[model samples]
Target: MSFFSEFREFAVKGNVVDLAVGVIIGGAFGKIVDSLVGDVIMPVIGKIVGGLDFSDYFIPLAGQTATTLAEAKKAGAVLAYGSFLSVLLNFIILAFVIFLMIKQINRLKRETPAPAPSAPPPTPEDVVLLREIRDALKR
Candidate 1:
């Protein structure tokens, strides 16, 4: 009825709560992925490609003769393609991991159908014969 109550109701809904939790976890996971790309994967890649840091790989757009990306940016506008590459790698890895998790979850959710109900067994031959004889006797 009141604004506060309405807001409270909306905020405490199951879907909203779940979404909030998901956002929090997603942010933390993003940090982890960023670290993985920046600290681990990028270093190895840079090493393989001749020991050049990807984050420092940028093109000077404003005619700055700076060596590092930080210096280039401090001097003038520069295209930071190296940082972009690292972030792109992070996104790819995160997407791949999420894809695998979703795939596994889907596989688990696919339930095998229960076997179809079978018909009851036929009556025994002796039972049928006995029933006929009893009916005849009664008549």
Candidate 2:
């Protein structure tokens, strides 16, 4: 077969198509999770932690205008460990969501019906007839 035929076959497979769709959706889902982390959760956390903005928190290795952590990075200063903390929080949320998904999937798998037990083998017809004949002889 030609390369185009092989490509067509590859593209048409159900699993491959499903994977492509899943990747697209997963990218969108990642953005949503990022937004949730950045917008909703972070602000609440900042308030709880004494009005601290994570994105603004960074350490400047070298700079004059770096009056605070935020100013350093905004002024293009390097060595920002504080930003790492914000990313770490995002990772934690993502992990929790994945864990919950796996747990639900596992629960569904457990609830599905198992294979039925096999029936026992039947007794042979010849054995039954012989038993009846022996009983008649005795009678």
Which number leads on TM-score?
1
TM-score: model 2 vs. ground truth: 0.76
lDDT tens digits, residues 31-112, model 2?
8888998899889989999998877676566654665765676677567665687778888988999899999999999999
lDDT of each: 0.95, 0.83
10 residues in a row with least lDDT, candidate 2: 58-67
How does model 1 fare in lDDT? 0.95
Considering summed lDDT, which 10 consecutive residues are worst modelled in model 1? 106-115
Tens-place lDDT per residue, model 1, 1-139, is: 9999999999999999999999999999999999999999999999999999999889999999999999999999999999999989999999999999999988887866678999999999999999999999999
Error of 2 at 15 (Å): 1.8
